[model samples]
Target: MLYLKSIGTPLVLVMALFALGGCEQAEKSAQQMLNQAAESAKQAIDKTNEAAQQALSEATGSEKTDKEDSKDADGQKI
Candidate 1:
């Protein structure tokens, strides 16, 4: 139908944009680009681990209720 075509066309355009987002070339200087990507990924993982450790350190308290309270206050899920 005409309505289906209208909705599908916009969705297709949006999907196309998303699909092209990660298609940037890895740079003419391949070694530099690879090293940059590796460093960025490493820093991201390190920050994630640091956040987890700080959350645990904050939440592991004297009693079950206190631990639960700290977790709730910090908005830490699980």
Candidate 2:
């Protein structure tokens, strides 16, 4: 139709410009989100390792007392 012919070209150009800007902004936002997620994941892993290490150290320390256990007449240890 003649109506489409007159407006189609300009609409296409405007749409193209808006799409390009939108894509650029989307890419920047995605990059920022990825960076934040990675940093948070790394911090969480570090904290978990620290906690595990602490728990293991504590468990090991309690399991084997620094002093040797004394034996009784029945060969039992207190």
Candidate 3:
């Protein structure tokens, strides 16, 4: 009985240490995944904004030309 008690404490402590180490590694992995997802979302948003701006510029440019073409040389409407 004395031999069993002496070995049991060390065994339990070693098991606890391993469990804590695994938990720490899991936390780090989760954090890394979250950071990657956030970066990807930010990049997607940036690309969407850029495309929207380009489309808006093109639309406005065509409208300006149409307005100019409808005017006479004296700046009066045709």
Best by TM-score: 3
Model 3, position 71: C-alpha lDDT score: 100
lDDT of 1 by residue, 1-78 (tens): 334234354445445555666343323334344455567668889999999998887676446676576675467955
Count of clashing pairs, candidate 2: 0
Name the candidate, 2 or 3, with the larger lDDT value: 3
Q: Per-residue lDDT tens digits of candidate 2, residues 1-78?
A: 334234354455445555777677656665565566567668889999999999999988876653334655675776
User: Model 1 misses residue 57 by how many Å?
Assistant: 0.6
User: For every model shown, what is its TM-score relative to the native structure?
Assistant: 0.44, 0.55, 0.69
Off by over 4 Å in 2: 1-22, 66-78
Give the least accurate 10-residue stretch of model 1, judged by summed lDDT. 22-31
Best by lDDT: 3
Which candidate model has the greater lDDT, 1 or 2? 2
Supply every candidate's count of residue pairs whose N, Cα or C atoms clash at under 3 angstroms: 0, 0, 0
TM-score of structure candidate 2: 0.55
Q: Measured by TM-score, how close is model 1 to the native structure? A: 0.44
Report the error of model 2 at residue 22, Å: 5.1
Candidate 1, superposed: residue stretches over 4 Å from native: 1-28, 62-78
